[model samples]
Structures are given as structure tokens and as C-alpha cells.
Target chain A: MQDPLGRLAAQIGSGMKLAVPVDYGGVPMALTRAIIAAGIDDLHLVCVPTGGMQVDMMIGAGLVKTIETSAVSLGEAGGAPQFNAAVRAGRVAMMDATCPAIHAGLLAAQKGVPFVPIRGLIETDVLANRLDWCVINNPMADDTGDDPIVLIPAIHPDAAIFHAPMADRFGNVWIGRRRELAAMAYSTKTTLVTVERMFDGDLMADEMTAAGTLPALYVTDVAVAARGAWPLGLWGEYDGDVAEQHRYAQAARTPEGFAAYMASDVRAGAA
Target chain B: MSTPTTAHEILIVSIARLLRGTRHVAVGAASPIPAAGAMLARALAETQDEPKLRLSILGSVAHNFFTNGSAELFDCAAQGRIDAFFLGGGQIDGSGNVNLVGVGDYPEGTVRWPGSFGSAFLYFQIPRVILFREEHTPRVMVEKVDFISAPGVSSEGIWRKGGPHALLTGKGLFGFDATRPGFHLQTLHPGHTLEDVTAATGFRFSHAHATPETPPPDAATLALIRGRIRDELHESYPDFAATLRTAPLPSPLKEPSS
Candidate 1:
């Protein structure tokens, strides 16, 4: 039998646009490592709003071709060294964006709209850099003076990958309050999820879980990968391994240090 | 009282003062001082029997009330529900433009800070935006930001409802004037002089003949910050809260020398 986790990783091929969530939201670190081990390259990574260690690792491994993100940092641990180096070296195509614009783009995709209008980014370099984003007068305005607004083009990624705390046998994943995951899943062609455990009962049947559950219709695949978001944290399950994160931040400063850190006992031990 | 105020405490007090009279204040992730200040303001308001202040600290389960994840924060801001917010940058200029992207050039720069988060939007939506950068230096406060992550002021025809209200740094506080579209030195922090501020700042800003010093937190305010505020902050910022525990207590004033 094929390893389900490997199968899920295989679903994410090279040179595909993949959307991932923020750090506090389930990060799918295990799946990220699996993809790295598979040596996938030229992936266009999209941070729903921002990225963290997961993004840095992928960039350090020379896997990302482009990054569409608001920001990519290790939270309090500090700047994402690998990401910084890559951008500074012009290794990756950086599509700089603000948080709302990214969300607006995703929302447009989710709604199957061509674009979504947002409030800000006018007269700023953030708007200037985004050639695809346009500004137009509000057509709905009642003949009032021009009401300029930003229109963010829809962002429909090839795949959405993330980790979740639980999933039922029916493939319904309980994302709890991390509704951004739902937006990603709704907007992507395929959504691959790695959950900590399987629920015996139908998630949709339970009143409490139903509200938080992402219907299996939107989820393309689900695999049980315990501690899938390890080193990162699952909202209710455990706290992030800050020490390990700090170590990665420190070690990944230099290219050689990053390569060595990737091969060290820490990476192996995470298995 | 002879309790020497730490820089962090001073900043917290200042932030709280800026946040006063606001109905709702939102803070972003990794902001300890701003988060503490919001908490302090909320606590102070409760004590004074004022209208309840709603605080939404992103990334905190206890503090954040949004059920729709990250989008809701922006959504709330767009509707002008968030009254006040805090924004920091790699560089801030005299015109109130902020650069969170990086330095040098566009796309690929010599140095790269994190990309712009929600500042471009939040800075436009929130009525009172307090720019906070703990580092006070010429490099950080530039004459012109290499990139404008979010502009401080927009043109006359631009549809903007909000912009920079004030700028607080480690050295002092600067108030942004929308009409002149410039920052003016408002008050210097304790132990810092005008000459020191001038040397540290890269951008030119106006100041009165003698800029007043930022008032330190009173005994009552310090007690609240060290006590209830610290305890409340622990839920989101554990390490920062721990440091607050060891902060100096107010010592009784000595009798006048005979």
C-alpha cells in the first residue's frame, strides 16, 4: 500500500501555484517537509496573508519560483533569513501585497468573480507594484464625486495544502475558527489536508462540529499525519516549539547553515 | 515616588494616552508594547466607569473576538469600526509615508524587511493611527522611504478617510499634520534631548522653542500596568508579561533635606 502521506505530497507537483495559511492557522509543516524531501521545485507559493518558517525552508531549498505574500517572517523570532536572502538575490519573483488585498483576491476567487473591490492601497507603492490590480470609480455611487476603489484580481491557486486538528471518516475537516482555510479551500482547484486524527462519527452530523467543519466536497483529499503542524502549533492541541523555531531562525541565516540545519538531527528527529 | 520608568513602560503609557477616548482599538501580532497599552487603556476605562472599550488583538484566542479569521479584521476596518490601530515600519519619513517592504530598490532590494501586511488598508480605515517604532535611528527614520508600504497622506482627490495621527519612537513623540503633511516633534522622552533627537532622526520635523517632556506614568497608572494589565497581557505575550513582573516599584519620596 502506498504511504497516504506520500500520496498527498505527490498530489502537489512542481511548478504549481499552492496557497498556504498563516502561522497560527494550521501550517502543515510535516507535509511541507515531505514536499521538500520529494524535491519539488519551481512552486509558486501564495501566503493567504503571510508566511513563516515553512516558507523560509522551501525558499532555502530552492523550491519556490514565486511568492505572493503580505509578509514572510518568523513572528518574534525575527526575519525569515532564507526568504530575505532569496529576495535580495532576486532568486524568487516577489509579488508584494498587503493583507486585505490578498484576502480580497481570494474572496473573489471563492465567489467565482473576476475581481473584488477593496478600500485601501491607493497612492501607495503596494498598489503601484501590483500591475494586475486596478483602480476604478465606484459605479454604484449615486452620481456623487468619483469614489475611487481598488479592484484585486481573483487568485485561484492550483492547490491548497494545510494541516487540521481533526477530520471525520467522511473527509470533513474541522478547522475550528481558522476560517481563512475555508477561503483557501473554496478558491483552490484542489485542497489537500493532513489531520492529526480521524473522527469516528460524521463531523457534519454533530451540531457543534458542523459549524466549523469544511465539507468533504471542498476537500480533495485527507490523510492522517499526527503532529502534522509540529514545530508550528495547532490552535487547541499544543503550543509552537519556539526553541526549535528560534534554532531554525539562527541556523538558517547562512546558506551552508541552512543546508546543514535541514540535514541535521532536528529534521530527522521530526520524523 | 522614585520609581524609574523603563523605556517599555514609558512607551506603554504613551500608547495608552494615544488610545484614550477610542471606542475600539485593534493591535496586530508580535506587538507587546502596543498590546499592553491597549490593555492598559481598557483597564483604565473600566476603572473610570467609562463606556467599555473593545480590544481585538490578532493571534490571541482570549483577546480576539473575530470569528471569521484574518479577513474580518480588514472587513471591520473597511467599515470604519476599528477606531484606533498601530503600524510600524522599516522606515518612516517626514511626510508620514511608511516603508515596511525594505530598503534600496523595488522587488529585489539590498535589505528586505517583511512585506506590507495590512498597513495600506488599516492606515486608511482607522481614524487614529499611532506609528510605533522602538528603534530611533537615522536609518529607520529616513528622509524618504525607499518604498511606500502605506502612504501617510493622499492627494486631494484620493478617497482616504484615515492617515497617520501620531508617531512614537524610543526617543520622543511626533504628531503628524495632515494639512502640512509633515511630522512635528511633540514631546521628548525622559533622558533624551533635542540635540540627541535631531542627530538620531533622518527626516526634518518642526518643534516648539522648548519641546515638552513626555509625562511618565503616575503611581496609580504604574500600579495598574504592573498589576492587572501585566496579568491580562500574559494570555497573549507571556515573555513580555514576565519582564513586567520585575519592573521597579514606586518608592516613597524622601523627606526634604534638613
Candidate 2:
């Protein structure tokens, strides 16, 4: 599959139930709409660092299998990056989403360098010991100095999916705003893109101006989906359908509930 | 040493001072404060306290143009152990809890609040979390939040129980009070009064004495932070710098609902 979200949803479905990055308003609507339409397994919502809270309700109600997070959206919520839900909810699967370049950072930690001295672990982790990825004891006295050498293992996933402002048919994407999009891209086996369908964005042409993080080959799919990324991008184009999104996040948490929600007026046509 | 000329400028400068000698920092959504702060600290100003302080910035807020490699935003250097985390709030109580989640409702929010992007985890794990708001008011600094997606000190009394690291607002600075459970008045910004601060805050505050005056941001720090922001952030986010006004003017606060 060339589509970014599709490839990711499909890849994870190969083994574990499908996991998708979701938020309160925009992407979740598109995502839940897709899940319900695709008729996938127990849909789990992966709340990104900056995601809204309704995604949690989806998890609470069982639409989501489990939540994987540390504390971006919440600290913005609670106070610090404190995992309030984790403290209350017994056990939740927490994985480092930014571990795509675990090898490089780990190399920096192990060798006592600023960053991985070399690109030896580009695709794999030679530096991860498992205790905690890696750490830098020397702390690099000379910000530019290369200290010791160690390996940081690869902790990516079967596949990862993201939504960016623009993407080429091949799947390369650009977020315009600086995001861990690259790290996330590197962290996953598959990185997808959802660009603006509007000709005004001139998104395809604008690609020339972006930082150029991913090459076409790096992306395996390029499925065209409208309003792929929501509130995150409404400023750019599409305004999110908040009410519809809330209903889906709440309903999708439960397969039965999501089924009913998917059967609603908005989702029915898509189904 | 010099002082910052504007509120946003001083904020970034002070952030740089705090970041001096630090190894890592995280800047989440709406994080020009931390991103520009660290860049200023790293590139321009060196704290007088530490001879050669080196603070490295990590995360997406820092994901601004300064990051040469997209890979820089990942890793322990960027994500693992962050020193300072910058945050904002639509609703806050005396306890320090923030409310970025919707008010009165969820996705179909009766009152839509910009979602809590990353604060959920950072609220506890991050060593330092600074709450910020350009416009301080009772609406923002409420007595009790209608909805609390994230808990700070939780309640006024709970503040004494050890929650929320710091509260930095447009009007003044407030920190934890080992003795006083709720908010302990730390200092007031120049050109402001206790009334100005209180009018914005719903809960009562404890103060040992009249709060001291907040020092204006020093010049060297401001210049340094501003330079990075103009260069690092403005590159990809041109509208950021263009869209931003040096001060709140008569113009509309946000882009008219597109």
C-alpha cells in the first residue's frame, strides 16, 4: 500500500491489533472514520504528545486496546510531564515514540559524544542495552567532541504512520513546522504522508522548499486521503469537525460503540 | 548584562538563563518560549554564575529550523531526560493543574480548548515545568477549573503537598511554598501590582512580604534568544515571526477563523 496511514494500519494489523495516532478533533475523525470503514480489529488510539484528551475516553471505554505515552499532552494538562492516568490506571504500554534514532543518541550516550559519532547504526541499534536505551556519562565537555563509543538498539515498530501537510504520490511528507516527523519517520518501518488535495496549497510544488527529510524510496505508500490531518492543519486548510470527531473518539473506543458511531450519518456514507 | 525589551523577549531570555549549564530541554506545542530560550543560552549568553554553561535543547518546539537534522528531535538528547519544559494553559487553578483539554465537553466540546499536546507526561517527569500566559486573567487563572485533564498541585492545600514546580505569568512569578500549601507569592513584574495579579487569579495567595519586583530580562540574553528565534524558528515558520507582533496591539488576537 502506498498510502501512509493505510500502510501503517495494515502493517501493525499483520500481528498485533492496529494502533493509530489520534487526537481529540481532527486526525481522530479521519482515523476513526477509516478504522470503522476498514472494519479493522479492536481499534486502539495512540495519543501523541500534543494530542487532545478525548482520545483517553476512547481508551477508557475500550475502543482503544491500550495507550502508549509519557507526558506531553497531559503535562500541558496536569502541570509537569506527570503521567496522572498511568498512576491511576494499573498498567499501560509505554514505548518511546522518539526512539527512531535510538542508535545515534545511544551512541552519543555510550561513547560520551554529543551525538552518535557515526551513522553505523542508521537502521539498527548497536547501542541499546535495554536498561534505559543509553546515557552519556562524560556529557561531552566540548559540545562538538566525540567521546566514547557504544550502541543504541533500534526500538521502532513493525510500522509507523504520520500526517503531514503535504506528501508526494510516493509518500514523502513535510510538516512545515519542525516536528519529530523525521525521527518518527526513521523510527517506523513505514512512514506515510497526507498532503493537501487543494491546488492552492501548491503542496506538491512546495515540497521543493521543505527540509527534505525523507526520500521517495523511504516511503512505501501514498494513499490519498482528504482531511488526513485535522486541527493540526485546519489553520492551513481544513477546519476540523469537532462534534463528529468527539463522537467517534468516544464511540470507537468500543468496537460495538464504534460500530454504531460508524453507522452514523457522517461515517455511513464512508462505510 | 542587559535587560530584555519586551515581555516575550524577556521570557525567552530568562529561559536562557535557566537553561545555562543544563544538558537537555523540551519544547512542546506553543513552545517558542523554551525553544528560543535554549538557543539563546546555547549560542549567546553565558550565565555569570557558571563559567561556561552548556545547555542543549531537545524536542519539537526546538524542532524549529535550528535543527539541521530531522533526527535531532529524537533520542535521549532530545526526548529522554529534559531539564526545562515550557507549557501554556487555558485554565489553571491554585494547585497548578492545567486544562488544555476541552471545557464542559470532549471532541464536541461546548467550549473547545486547544488540546493538551504533550503536558500529560511532562507534567510530572520533567524536572522543571514553567506555566506561561501572555495575557494573565481570572478567566485563565481561575479558582477552580471547570475541567482538569492534568493535575498540578490539584487543590490549594495540595500545593503544599508537593505539586507543580513553578507558575510564570505575564504579571509575576510564583513558586511552591514549603510552608504555605497553595500559591506563595514570589515576585511581581515591574509596572504591575498585587491587585493586578490577584484580579487574574481566582484563589487567594500567601506572601511573606510584598513580592519583590521581577528583574527585567537582561539585554545580552534577550539579544541572544531573539537572534536564535529569528533565525532558527523563522526559517521554516516564516509566518511565526511575521505573524507575531512585538506586543499585543489593537489587531485581532488570532487569525480570523479560516
Candidate 3:
């Protein structure tokens, strides 16, 4: 159950229900396909605000449920600049998810530290809703005495699925970059990893990727899914398919719209 | 007729070097230059000629990589890490404020279009944000944008994700000053001057007195770029290839190819 990828596939209770980022390649792609194969509705997808691993084929598989993203992306493909009329017509369900990964908000929750100092939460209900937010006494002991700090409870996903460059057969994973990935890695209760190629020893032998393996140990299952990060983009070396993206955008703007689009494909149409 | 050199190819090469051999670099929607460059870099690196640089890519299905057609590197996308990226701005104010989304009222615009699609987060969290443009105009570079698409100096309470590093254009290059958070002119390009630059911008600038000019793309590099666009890229995308209706006569490229 702790194997991130495996648990992720199982968490949504099969029957086609899933939510994941909208990315170009890598982990996001793995999540989409795995979700579909696991029997989650492909239409229930969460779109990452930034560039990340995402798959449109899942929608064609009737595996997506809803898109939780920014209000800006709602019409990204349908309007001018570059228009995909079919997507605008509502083939998939799009939701103004309001960027689930608000760095400050999410970071606050992940640390379990009360009142994690964060900006941009001023004067809004968003800051008020978190009952756990508590303030810290300042050194000055000023009468403005309401504390300044806040508490961010850890946000462990039902599971975290990822595609890594390398992983040991035992399921020890290796991620090349450790930006905010640690936040997502530790925050999740379960993790699934797919490596580019299998290896026997610990990926930690290399100094750079050594620390990368620690988080993998926190994961549940490690699988060898070569080139698992498809559709979503990789940063330095590879590029993605532009035409397929257009086709996806044309298909994934609404529920009914995407359903018809899914019907067009055989394998993708039936989950 | 014959094919001449192209700025697009030159721009793509410049970007590949910036990536420093990373397998994937993040890109946003509607940015054709970086998208194309990112794809081309992966293609060249994967080929036997540059086997040392083993790389490929997978763009988003929602049209992130504006390549001419389907991409060959679909497998790499499963890894999903777009830490660095490039963005565009229709209005970049002196304060380094960007506005690409839309302007004016809700829905119906009294003024500009939706300011930025993703510049806000891209500028802060992506680690590397290389803002680029070809047409340097006052409209593009303003004193202050009507809207601040992304916050350069995010409030201390908030951990500002990504911020831009460089501003590239045909006229010159600008890098961000961590202290100032705005642009410090780095280098001017060939056949350009302060007058030409200032004339194009709509904002106030602190120009450097000794700004140097960027050297033009060299002959050898140009030839290599030409070959890729004409022969390699053309073969990949016949439609794009057709755009190159003719070629210019050859000159001193690669010292006559030995």
C-alpha cells in the first residue's frame, strides 16, 4: 500500500476516478496512464499550473473526471493565439481548481510547524479558513500581540506516483532534482516510482543523486517503466509532440465534449 | 533560389547552450521559439553525432511544444520535471512587472488582453526564466505594465517560487539584478545602438554607458544552423520546409568545409 505508484493507482477505488497534474512529460504522464489503467475515470484529472507531466490520452480512456487548475487555462486552447475549437466546445470537464499547489499555502501545511511564515495570505478568507493557523510571539513583545507565525499540517496524498531516471530493483527510487519535490515526496503517504532503466545497486552511489534516493525509500513500489514520462516534458534534453497537444486540447475542454472525443479512439475509449 | 540563414535557428542554438545539457527544460504555451528550440536540442543530442548528449523530450498534450508535428521523444515526458523555462510578455514595465494575461475589465477588455498565461509562477519558481522577444518595441517594454502579471519581490510571508534570470532579444540582452529585481543591460547586439533601443521601449531605463555589442553569429555556426534548418528540420516537417522556398549562395562557412 505504501508503494507510491501502486497505491496511487489503487487509492481512487478504480472505476475510473483520478486527479493529477497537467504537465508535458515525466511523472505526470505516468500518473495519467496508470490512473486510467487502474480504472479511474480519465476525465477526473488535475492540471498542474506549471509545466509538468500530463497525459491527454487518459481522457480518451474515459479515466479523467475533472480538471482543477487556474481560471486562466480554461480557454487556453480554445481562443486565439492558437485555437482548438473542439476543446472550447467542452469535451472534458474543466474546473477553476485555483492552483492546488499554492506554494505558500501548501508549504504551510507540509511542515507541521505552526504558523509557517508566508506572504500573500493577507486580508483574505483563504488565510482565515485554516483553523490551525496560529501566531508566534515576536521578540519585541509588541501589543500588536497577535502572533506572526502559522501552522501548516502535513498534506499526505493518498499516494505519490513518479517516474525517475533510475531506481534499484528493490524499489529504491532516484530523482535528479530536489527543488520542491521533497515537499511532495514527504507529504504523501504512499509513493509509486518508475525508472528509466533498472539497476542493482543504490543510485545513491553518485554524490549528486545520492540524496535523491532517500525520498525513494519513503516510496512504496518501484517499477521499471522505461520512458514512463511521456506527453509531459523533460527540462534539459527532450522535446514533446506539438500536434498531439493540439489534438488533446481540442478534445479536453468539457465532459460531454471529451466523451465524444474518447469515443473516437478504441483503446483509449474503453478503460 | 537558395536558403539564407535564419534568426530562428540561431535563437534555438543559443537556447540549447543555455540549458547546459539538461534533458528537459520547462516551457509554457504559445512560445514557439523556445518550444522549437527545446525539441531540436533533444533531436540533435539523441543522434549518434552527439551520443554523449543522450537526451529526448515530451511536451504537454495541451500544445506546449509548438513543433510542426508529432514528436519522437514521448517517453521522456513521463518523468515530468520542467524546472526551467522561457516566457513572453506583451507588457513588461520598468519594475520588471509582466502582463500577458489580459487587461482592463472582466471578460470584455477595456484595454489589453489577458496578461500572462503563466509568467507569474514561471518568473518565481521555475529557477530559470529567460524572457525573450524579437520585436523590441515600447509597447512590449513599458515604464510599468497596466497589470503586474507576476510579483518580482514576493512578500516575505510567501515563498516566491520563480523569478526570471535573463531578458533576450535581437537588440540586446538583459539580466536581473537580485538587488534591484529589474533588468541591468548586459550586451547590445550587432548593428544596434542606444538610440534604436530606447526608441523601441515605452518605459524608463537605466542604460549603461559602456554597454558592449553582442558579436554576430559566426560563419561556421551559421552554416551548421543553415544545414539543420534546410536539410534536417525540412525533412522532418515538410510544411515548414516548404516555407524555405529558396536558399542563398554559399560563402565562407566552415572554412569551405575542409
The TM-score leader among the candidates is 1
Tens digit of per-residue lDDT, candidate 1, span B1-258: 456778888999999999889999999999999999999999889988988999999878888889997899999988888999999999999999999999898988899998899998888888999999999999999999999999999887677888898999999999999988789999999999999999999989999999999999998888888888898899888999988854353455654679
Query: DockQ score of candidate 2?
Result: 0.08
- In candidate 3, what are the lDDT values of residues A144-236, reduced to their tens digit? 434343333333345545555667765666554323344444555555556667777766666765764645457666665544564433444
> Tens-digit lDDT track for model 2 on A1-271?
2434444345434133222343321243344344334444444333333334334433333344444332224212222111223323333343322222333432343344544422111111112212444444334545654443233443344444555455654345555543444444454556544445422333345545445435565565555556666433332455445455455445544446744654563344343
Query: Total clashing residue pairs per candidate?
Result: 0, 56, 118
Candidate 3 residue-wise lDDT, B44-72, digit = tens: 56552553322222233333333311111
Per-candidate Cα lDDT values, in order, are 0.91, 0.47, 0.48
- Give the 10-residue window scoring lowest on summed lDDT in candidate 3 chain A: A78-87
Residue A90 displacement (Å), model 2: 26
> Considering DockQ, where higher is better, how would the candidates rank from best to worst?
1, 2, 3
lDDT of 1 by residue, A1-271 (tens): 7678778889989999999999999999888888888888999999989999999999999889999999999998999999999999999999999998999999999899999998878889999988989999999987777889899999999999999999988889999988999999999979999999999999999789999999999999998888888788889988899998998999999988898988873357345
Model 2, position A56: C-alpha lDDT score: 43
Best-performing candidate as measured by lDDT? 1
**Model 2 chain A poorest ten-residue lDDT run:** A120-129
Error of 2 at B139 (Å): 2.0
- Runs in model 1 lying further than 4 Å from the true structure: A265-270, B246-258
Instruction: Locate the minimum summed-lDDT window of 10 residues in model 2 chain B.
Output: B154-163
Off by over 4 Å in 2: A1-18, A22-271, B1-4, B44-80, B104-117, B153-163, B225-228, B243-258
